[model samples]
Target: MGGTRVRTRYGRFGGALAAVVAVLATLAPVSPPAHAAPAPSVAPDPFFTYAGSTPLRELAPGTVLKTRTLPYRVAGVPLPLRVVQIVFRTTDQQGRAVAGVTSVIKPLTGTTSRVISYQSFYDSLDPEHGPSRAIAGSTAPGAMAAHVETVLMAAFLLRGYAIVMADTEGPTADFAAGPEYGRVTLDSIRAALRTPATGIAPAAKVGLVGYSGGAIATNWAAVLAPSYAPDVDRRLVGAAEGGVLVRPAANLRYVDGSRIWAGVIPMAVVGVARGFGIDLMPYLSDEGRRIYARLEKAPIIEVLGAYPGLTWADLTQPAYADPASIPAFVRTVNQLNLGTRPNPTVPMFIGQGTGGQLEGTRGDRPGLGKGDGVMLAGDVRSLARKYCAGGVDVVHREYPLSHFTSVPLWLPDAIAWLGARFAGRPAPDNCASIPAGNPLTPLAPAR
Candidate 1:
């Protein structure tokens, strides 16, 4: 009788627990299995190619070459959202027509009237590492940056803002080629507006947002839009960027021998050569040549800190030790310098950091002053001041943070600033108080 009672009590308790679970299951449906399927291969996808009968040069910039829709995924895990990918014709750094790809992610609510051109800082020398591949479920190391950016993209999406992520590096992944980045970005927005699948109106008011490498694209797009794509420019609300690259030549000098950012020296070398179709191989030292060959197809993840204390002298032949001595480099970097370009017409919000020591980069460098590890804060200030002087509204902020850490602080303020712009608020400007910064003179070839 005792055993029977014990069994009966336990059975009743089990039945009650089962009933509770059933009710809870009804309230919250079960999600898909947590284990994601195998990631797609890292090999280049042929869909990126523009195989149409007409040459790319024959097509107008922003002309749509191809369009497809795919499920949005983050690091190989599929999300409920779907994204539209567009292949568009855009100009390269050398002014040649090239193919570019951009991914348009709509909010779950399906509102597409407001859009943000969220440039991805997926800095890589490999085209396969572009954002489109990551969105399509590739788990490659190079594509990881794009995968990580999906979280930030989701923030905009949650706010009922559609995000257009251009592979700003272009089809060839010309990392750090700022002009090409701008061209690709503007063209991507053009393509997104033209695509019916994206549901973005042709007259959608667009704002640009990016940090680090993305800032290169954001600022350039703003600068070039007035002439390169006036139709897109007129619709611009404003631009928000952090860690701006004002003058590439100064940056090259600033980051030389940096413990963390020195690797960017060779990456930029490879990217500039690829973007401009210039052959710099003859000027490289044997060690430089080996480093270049090894990093020709590397991503920024594999680069940072890989070559601590590397410098231009270490990378060039003895006679070409000074980068300015290389005629091609002088011409290319000057072209890449934001200071040489016309000021952007749109109101701008620029954020810069000055705590480079935290990232192993020294704060004291003659003429360069303090920087945010990779980008010089003073350079950013100079660019902002230049924009302000040109009658553009500018709001500049500085933080005692390194390049990576500054993002967390900059992002929230950037989003709020952009929101204010969209709401027709008067853009803010601190031009009168902005301190003088480093000179942004273009580099001249060494005599």
Candidate 2:
């Protein structure tokens, strides 16, 4: 379903949005008051914890847990912040801490603008296939957890913000897609609120941000907001998704023989099927099963070039031969193409980058609609207009950059847009009634 125009890798960190703040604090000398006694020497306790009988089940060994205070200046007014460590489970199945993979609690910060806001990030991981049926030494079970440490830590830290990246896929490395993703996202936010440091107002506001697979979580989080976490005082605010995979079925079809994604589809299939207890061998031919089983754990891009000897005609043959036998495949793909309707809880900010090719084809297409089918500017504009008409504050922007190039540019704007909502700004007008042209173009305020 996708192709990369540029190939650049990013790094992951263990709570280093910047250099260690405590270390910096220690290095800087402090002038004691004339009447003050000497400061006490203390040992460092990095684990962020609580003294309660009702223990949260997710906390595990080798995970670094700590609180981060986020301060942002708005119109010269200083804003106090609290980002507590709720719970972050490590991805190691040996029950040991794995380096560079973790999840934390993101808190609710009350806004001087009267809109309370909270944010979190979920990154993807890669699952591996081993020699035996009972695999061992697995670090993280799914792609959602695979490379997340690099993507999320870089994105959140640079913005002067802290995020709770929950390894919600559980200890078995289960990547709970769709509705399951929504549950974990909301529960983590709730857990963050319950942490003592958050100082949550009863009327605190909330919003979401995610990219690619993470966008799947963000989209469902927005849809489930009204029903699931109503007490959290959340509004959609705005959501900026990059290369969103909304239509799972369409994505599967596109990636079957597509360059750079051949491995991705099969990996997702085996991983998801295993998670759901579906056996794929019955649906695949002996040769098809053999190839899929071997390449299931391979990295996405690496898998594509492995089969170059095969023709496009060979790749599309399996799909055309049998459709009924792959019910799980059908269900999995169908989940990707979500329906069109406003979240009703808050406005949205949707965006797409021109860097990745969708459906194994590339071109500048207008009137491209939202969901997983196509990544066209025109469809995005049309969706933006619809959200605007329903009294949702919808803002759509297209950059000249590719998928990865636009992340840095999009992060700040996404954060600020949600920040405005947390500040209690009124949602912008509905776009449903707006003309298709310039749907994302900001209009002049009525005099």
Candidate 3:
């Protein structure tokens, strides 16, 4: 609560405890170099469109198959730094080994033992909007959102940390598939550390940091590491995430009638359906199908705040009126739920924004704990405490501001927390001090 009050009142990017390098991110003007016009967008190669001969069935999940040089860019301009791309093996939710790519940004000078797998919150169902396009200077709306991470990535680079940006969505661009996100992230780390050109040592220390949609990937990666990617798990010192979506079912309920966030319903539905290979047409009402079709290829930036007061009732058939009643959605969302998963073995830094009402609410119901504009703060707190109970080192912070303000404010702490982990200092455990958060419960089946 003390930490919550501190962040609530003054959510500045660099607080009084600003590190030297973190402050450089704000002071040193970005220096992106000149580059030729972007390559013609010839139906840009889709992620996971692998042409390799080895059947995916025979390879391990972290095998790196291909490599290429990437132009490091911020906005439309490329940076005069070495950037390498690695396409490696990863798994889908059902355990199929698929391919994933990671962008490795080598610092202009110096080497660090730590590698930061910075996940961008590029929330989109379209392939063009994935991280690869952003690296190539695609100006698509969703692709532009990828620049949001470049600023932070620059901070990591300035600190001499080799940066790894994974296309966590996988070949199909499974936007909200939490398990796929985890698998892709862990494998990307594997590809980064093992590849000789990346300059990452065999035992390079790793940490994760993300917000919003990226937070989903970061959290899933942390939980999945111990069981699915034990090699990566042993290397991860800590992870920092803010405004995470721990419970998709609860998020759907929280955003159902929200004035601005309600727009997320259709996007999430379509993404989840694609992630699980489930055709939702039968379950959707006429209006629902139309909405889903429209947003099937839409990006979060283009659609945000566009549709207010949307609801499942407005989209789905009356028979499939209740979202939980739809068996496919219920099952898939349960798989995506982070609360039902194992605790991360490494230390965690989880932050929440508790000002949900900042954004308009069409007919918002109570019970979903105070959220940022989109995610529930109470749910984030619950996940943090659960981590504590499971004996993981946990650092939970809360802010009174809305989601937008919370993102920038939490970075200082995130950077500092991750730094502490890499420094081998013990993270302060809040297990005893943290009051009980919401119960870590799975979504119930429909009657």
For this target, which candidate reaches the highest TM-score against the unseen true structure?
1
TM-score of 3: 0.88
In candidate 1, list every pair of residues with a backbone clash: none
Better of 2 and 3 by lDDT: 3
Full candidate order by TM-score, most accurate first:
1, 3, 2
Which residue pairs collide, candidate 3?
none
Reference-based TM-score, model 2:
0.59
Global lDDT for candidate 3?
0.78
List the candidates' TM-scores in order.
Answer: 0.90, 0.59, 0.88
Which portions of model 2 miss their true places by more than 4 Å? 1-102, 105-162, 168-176, 197-203, 233-238, 286-288, 294-325, 340-344, 355-390, 429-447
In Å, residue 352's CA in model 2 sits off its true spot by 0.7
lDDT of 3 by residue, 1-447 (tens): 976754443333223113323433453212122232433554765443678899977998888888877666544556555678888988976678787788887754445588999887888888777776777666565675555576665566666789888888887778789888988999999988888888787768999888888898899999989898898998998999998898888888888877778878899888888888888888888888877877777777656676777889989888887887888888888888788888888999988887778876422456676778788877787888888888999988888777777877798889988888989998887777665656657767789
What's the residue-level lDDT of 198 in candidate 1? 89
Q: What is the C-alpha RMSD of each candidate to the true structure, in Å?
A: 10.5, 15.7, 8.2
Tens digits of lDDT, candidate 2, 338-414: 44433545677666655545333234333233222223444455555655655566766666554455666766666
Task: Output the number of the lDDT-best candidate.
Answer: 1
lDDT of each: 0.86, 0.42, 0.78
